[model samples]
Target chain A: METRDALLEAGAALLREQPVGAVLTQVKAQPVAQRAGRTIGAFYHHWSSQEAYHRDLLAYVLDPQRLLSTAAAADTVLADLPRGLPLEEVVRRAARRNFEIVRANPYVPLILALWGKQAQDERVRELLRAHYRSVTDRLVPVYRTLFDAYGLTMRPPYTVEMFAATLTALVEGLTVRAAVEPEVVPLDLPHAGDLSAAPGAGAAGAAPWDLFSATVVGILRAMTMPADPA
Target chain B: METRDALLEAGAALLREQPVGAVLTQVKAQPVAQRAGRTIGAFYHHWSSQEAYHRDLLAYVLDPQRLLSTAAAADTVLADLPRGLPLEEVVRRAARRNFEIVRANPYVPLILALWGKQAQDERVRELLRAHYRSVTDRLVPVYRTLFDAYGLTMRPPYTVEMFAATLTALVEGLTVRAAVEPEVVPLDLPHAGDLSAAPGAGAAGAAPWDLFSATVVGILRAMTMPADPA
Candidate 1:
């Protein structure tokens, strides 16, 4: 790998374990350079300062393309659902796929660590804001397609934008909860066939991922179903 | 006022502006004592160490009784809903009340600031966990009452516990979002009478709190409705 790529890779790996602030202060340039098998000079050669390196790191980790690529498999899974599948089933599949994506890509800890810095760092805040907007823009259409598939209209007082926003917030929020309160927010995915027959069964024993998926799908269904005209 | 109480008050006020870690190192005990108009001796007289002071501050701010008392007015608003009110209306009222409570007693920033310390501080983590449990415990029965009033059974595959958990997660998640992304997660509470006629009115220009309240009510209604057998 190129020297710059190596440093980026090393920084990303280190950040996953320790926060950027801690890494910058405690480890400094030697450890990251050593981890990359490059000298401290090489580290400074590519980046002007620690803050600059952090900016690039934030950009690299949160790059829209990288996130979309990581999520591509899940997108494919959602796209391949049978046309005749119930909307609920489609939503369930989507939620499961999303949970699986988060589990495999495990970025919550890094994000939470960075979030603390957001209060002081404009670049960090901007990067996160852009990432959020990008994710929502990509997913809103997917949600619209699912709603269209069932001929279900979201009840008045709600819109596709609102749905996307709430869904994103829920997923992100739950991800944070799972990180800090793992017992409260498990990530295990359960067999779909078992959901209706034993709802509380999973509550007692299902992994956090399973509960998360179920909750997301349930909220989607609840949010999109046409309101009854009493 | 007692010296200890004055110090706690001073610490709480400082924390609202800066994190505990920063305050401990950057300003130290003298600043806090100065802020409280007490001498450094008085600061030590009440507390042995910075960590000890932090614990007391956490206890002081997150005192369950204080939280409950602050929330009592909102609870009364929810409890007094007319029996004849529609389930949807009841949910809307409840959402509005919850939002109002959060708005009246803003704590998301404090909670988020404290959350970063949880990994190292067992007491902080335990305090948060207990707070979550207390809030959930207090709200679950109220949800049951709302469900009963409507003669609506939460479909299988969903339990009161799950409902409470998901609802709490969504509210807390959105609250955080509103704090960080005010433009994205508006908290405007629309005039209840204008919802149907002015669905897009809020979108066009309602305050963020209104939008937040509507989103929460909509999610609650969606989550609690009986499942369709189709």
Candidate 2:
């Protein structure tokens, strides 16, 4: 890899472990240089200041490849499931897989931290827009596939994009809540209703219908209808 | 008001205007003391350090009265509607009022900023938990009122608390997204479907159905069912 790529990858690896608010100050040139197997001179040779380096680093982290990997993993979970699963099952599997994927990804906190940073940094704001655009692009197809398999279509006035955006926001929002109040947003509670029954009609049984999954199932059912057999 | 109350309120007012991430360092002793019209010694008399003052500030802002006010406003929007409105209308009105209330509030940024700060500050985390509890307490009654008016009830496994939490997260998450990318998460668009029609049946016309409202409508519809007339 090129020196720039090496530095960014190293910086991201370092950032993965650090908490969100205090990331930029920790991005020292010498340490990043050492991690990249380059010198301080090389760091400045590429970027003039820490601000400039941080900008490039934001762009680097927002790379579509890194951003879409988690989505892709979630998609695989859905795809691997057997055909003809009930609507509730489909949503539950997707939500649980998504929760697990997001929880496990170290970059999630860093990315969430940047949500506030965008207010002060226009460049960071621009990078985030691009990141979200890519995220939406990747997610739209996944929704399309899921809806297709489930024999559903976007409710009128609601596009796949709308569904995708809501799901994204819910996952991010719940993750923030869960971090602070784990008891409130448990990842998997005993399924509140019968495992075989549809939502809004759960009987006492065991399944993974926590807040995240329950909400996702609700959104999915609300935003879709059976495809017309025209 | 007491000196401490005055100081905390002044700090909160100041924080309301600033953007989210760069909040803490801006919480200096001198300015807060000046704004509160007290001596810097008074600031020290109340709190030994800036960090201590900020902790108090978080607690002050998290006061249930201030936090629940927005929820109250949204509830009023629902209550003001005529009896027996369609479910979509109810959800849309509630969602639009919430979007407006949240968009207009000055303290949203500061509150959102605390989300990322929770990782490092145990007290902030505790304060947030308390704030959420109060928010849920306020919202449950609102949901019950809406559901009662509509003759709906929580689906077997879904409770009022889950709905309230999801709605709160959606607003916060979308606000963060809107701050960075307003175009994607618009507040109001020309209603895509007919004013009289339910969702999944939009004709190019006028109404308020943006991403936030649309998502809320979906969640509401999915999470509730018709009450049996026993």
Candidate 3:
């Protein structure tokens, strides 16, 4: 790999293991350079300053490609939807797959830490905004197609942008919940075989993910179904 | 007024201004003591160590009383529900009040920071667990009564526990979303008058909070409504 790429790769790996704040301060250029098998001089050659290097590393760690790839993988599964599959089933599959991807990824904590930083740092805020926009741009069309496939008309006051944003927020929120209060949000860990069985199969008796998936499908249905004329 | 209380208040105040990690490390006894207008001896007299002081501060900052008081205030409004008010209106009012409380609280970022800490720290993890339980214990009955008042029966896989947990996560998640990408989550700030108008009165031409409240109400309604026999 190129010198810049190697440094970023090392930084990303280290970030997954420690808090972003720690990575930025305590773990500096020398450690990252050593991990990349490059000297501090090599690190300085590619980046202007340690802070600048860290900023680039943050961007690389949260690259839109990671999210897009997850979306793409979901698309592949969604593309092969069995004929006449129920809308709820499709939602369950999609939600479960999305949940699994987030659960498996080590970068969630780092992404969340950066989210916390966005409140205080303008540059981080802009980076996250751009990241959100890129993900939304990529996913909105997929959601539109899914709605079209199901022949469901999204109700007024709930646009495709809102759906994509809501889904992203929900997933991110639940990820935190699972980490902090697992008993309450007992999402099942990803298993080897089928994604369908993974939602409810937990060692702990509660099927939190099953409940979560059902709620997600319900929300989607409620948002898309024609409004009742009371 | 008391020494212990004074120290906690100082810590909470400082925590709101900076990241919790910084508060945990850089802002130690002397700064907190000075902030509290007490000496370092007074700080040590109240707490065993910095970590212990932080743990107590975490408890104090996330005290369920704050949440319950907000819930209680909402209850006062619900108690005076004018006859013939639609169920959705009730939901809108309740959701809006909850959103307002979270948005107004400076402790939100601190709580989120602790949530990020939960992955690596056992004490923080347990504290959050206990916090979740206490909040759930307090809120579940209130929700049950609300659903009962509306003659709605919560569907299977969406228990009162799940509802409470999901609602909490949604609020926290949206709080972070608003901070990072305010344009996307554009929740309206709390207004002076009725909570009813607080949802949609945005100048940006898009009522993000209105959409958010509607989506939340929809999720609640869907979870509580009777199942349709296919």
Candidate 4:
């Protein structure tokens, strides 16, 4: 690759150990030199500013390729679920796969913490949007496909749309919470409840990922069914 | 009010006009001094540090009282819904009232930004948790009542829990978006489909409200119902 790529890799390594904010200080700026065995000017030669480099670092960590790979892996495995297999198992497996992929990339959460909400640069914003949307696109279809297997009635684009939006929103969000508030719940997905049975019911578990995934699945299950007069 | 109260209120007002990160430097600190006619040490004497003061300022903005008041107002209106008025109208009207309430509290978003993710102080974190839960208590019931009213099941506590966790997470996140990326929809609650119809579907034509109330109601609408599947 290029000179910039090497610097970003160095930065990403630093970011994995500490938040990007920690790296921006004057004192920390010195370490970049030691790491590269060069001066600040040399680091700045290709990247415009430290902030821009951080953004780029996030891009490299959250590359669409990584996300799509995880997504495709989950999708292909889920697609092969035998009609004999319970719907709950398929949903649980897929949810677990998604959670594990996100967990592997701790830098993904850090990058999102700093940039997913706002980036002044158009390119940065576009990159954040594209990366986020790609994940949603993959999950949305998976949810839709699962609903079909259950022989349940589902809503139109809105059902898929809201589910898609919430999933992306929640996963990105829960990652942040896990990093900051580990005590709230360990980041793990729950796998329970018979999918073909009570769609609204969830599996019992302490892992946040499980609970979160189960909850999303439960919500999807409920949405597939029409309004009930309790 | 106590001296502490005065300081907090002053800080909140000052924060509205500019970034809290910049508050100590030139603009507001001087204005606060001029108005109080008190010296810098006088204020510092009451607090642990400037950072502490800002943390307290955030606490005041996110005070449980304010959150409860909003939640209470929404609930009072919610209780009235099962009365003579039509359910659909009640939903629309409730959404409107909530929009207005959230728009009124300009400091909500500011306070959220000030809190960031990893609060250094225990009190601030507890304060934020309490403040968010206040809404969850009121809003969760509203969701339960609605879904139960029609016998339409939601994800129950998971939905409620997710609603609370994700709502605050989105706030921390979207505020950053507003500053640099006002156009990217973090929760898209404002632009979601009409709450009266599809609850979670973000509709356009949303009127702005105080940050807290809008977000509370926004999450309520966003989490309570799922979009239709195609």
Candidate 1 lDDT over B20-43, as tens digits, reads: 243112224554565555566766
Worst 10 residues of 4 chain A by lDDT: A18-27
lDDT at residue A64 of model 3 (Cα atoms): 80
Question: Candidate 1 lDDT, tens digit per residue, A1-230?
Answer: 54323322332232222222431222244555654556667667766876666445556556676464226634854575556655445555567666556544434434444554555568777877777678767877776766666576775445676666676666666654554566665444343222453345434433333555666554454445443434
Each model's C-alpha lDDT? 0.53, 0.63, 0.59, 0.46
* Model 3, docking class: incorrect
How well does each candidate superpose onto the true structure, as a TM-score? 0.68, 0.77, 0.76, 0.57
Weakest lDDT window of 10 consecutive positions for candidate 4 chain B: B18-27
Best of the two (2, 4) by DockQ: 2
Give the alpha carbon lDDT tens digit for every residue of B166-216 in model 3.
777777767766666666664552221122323643222332344456667
Q: List the residue pairs that clash in candidate 2.
A: A156-B200, A191-A207, A193-A203, A194-A203, B193-B202, B193-B203
Put down candidate 2 lDDT per residue, B2-51, tens digits, no spaces: 43233223322222232124345445666555544566776667667877
lDDT of 4 by residue, A104-190 (tens): 553443344335223334665676667666755666666666666767554432356455554454555555454445444334433
Candidate 1's docking class is incorrect
Clashes of each: 19, 6, 0, 33
Q: Please report the candidate that would top lDDT against the real structure.
A: 2
**TM-score of candidate 2 chain A against the true chain A:** 0.77
Quote the positional error of residue A22 for candidate 3 in Å: 5.8
In model 3 chain B, the worst 10-residue window by lDDT is B189-198
For model 4, residues B1-230, the per-residue Cα lDDT tens digits are 44323322332222222212321111233333334555555555655554555444444556666653357446765676567543434444564455445434444433333334333446645765666557656666775666566444433233455554555454444443344434333323333222335453333335433232333443444344432323
Best by TM-score: 2
